[model samples]
Target: MFRVLHRAGQSHDLTYVVVVIGVVVVHVVLVLVLVIVVVVVAVIGGVEVVLVLVIVVVVVVVVVVVVVVAAEAASAPVPIVLTTVTFLFGERTWR
Candidate 1:
């Protein structure tokens, strides 16, 4: 009976080197992907913050203007009273 004999003296250094290189490449790729994701998230967050600030500023300005206009209107005398007085007294006498 003839039996095939396998050699057990093979050095696994090449295999180890290949595996190490592959691991390094994969790690580099993952790190690059993570950096890109972080940068994108930061940029989006910055834009959102700026947009919110702008909206807040606009709202504040609109409210201030509305309040000022309302105060002015409330403090002033009635237009109808002035008009009636002017009509009764005549323009020259009132002036």
Candidate 2:
């Protein structure tokens, strides 16, 4: 996670990139949902599409918020260590 942040920070435009990408993704999802809802409404003329669109919009917003939060937190350094241990066992008879 920190690796990604480090790379982004190196570019000296991490904040701008995150904002731009977030906006683009949100817009794309919003437009796609609107188009789908319109098509469904036209074909079925049912009110259920409104509920679906609302749910999709909420989900999109939540997803974007989560991504932004995660990315922002990733800017901090994280310590990770790996170690290998060998265990020796005496030979024994099975009961």
Worst lDDT 10-window in candidate 1: 1-10
Give the alpha carbon lDDT tens digit for every residue of 2-94 in model 2.
333455578886654454445456558767876776677757856676677667767877787567556655663321110000001111211
Clashing pairs for predicted structure model 2, backbone only: none
TM-score of 2: 0.37
For candidate 1, lDDT tens digit of each residue in 17-40? 343344345446756755565567
| Alpha-carbon runs more than 4 Å astray in model 2 | 1-11, 46-95
Estimated TM-score for each candidate = 0.34, 0.37
Quality of model 1 by C-alpha lDDT: 0.46
Number of backbone collisions per candidate: 0, 0
**Which 10 successive residues of model 2 have the least lDDT summed?**
79-88
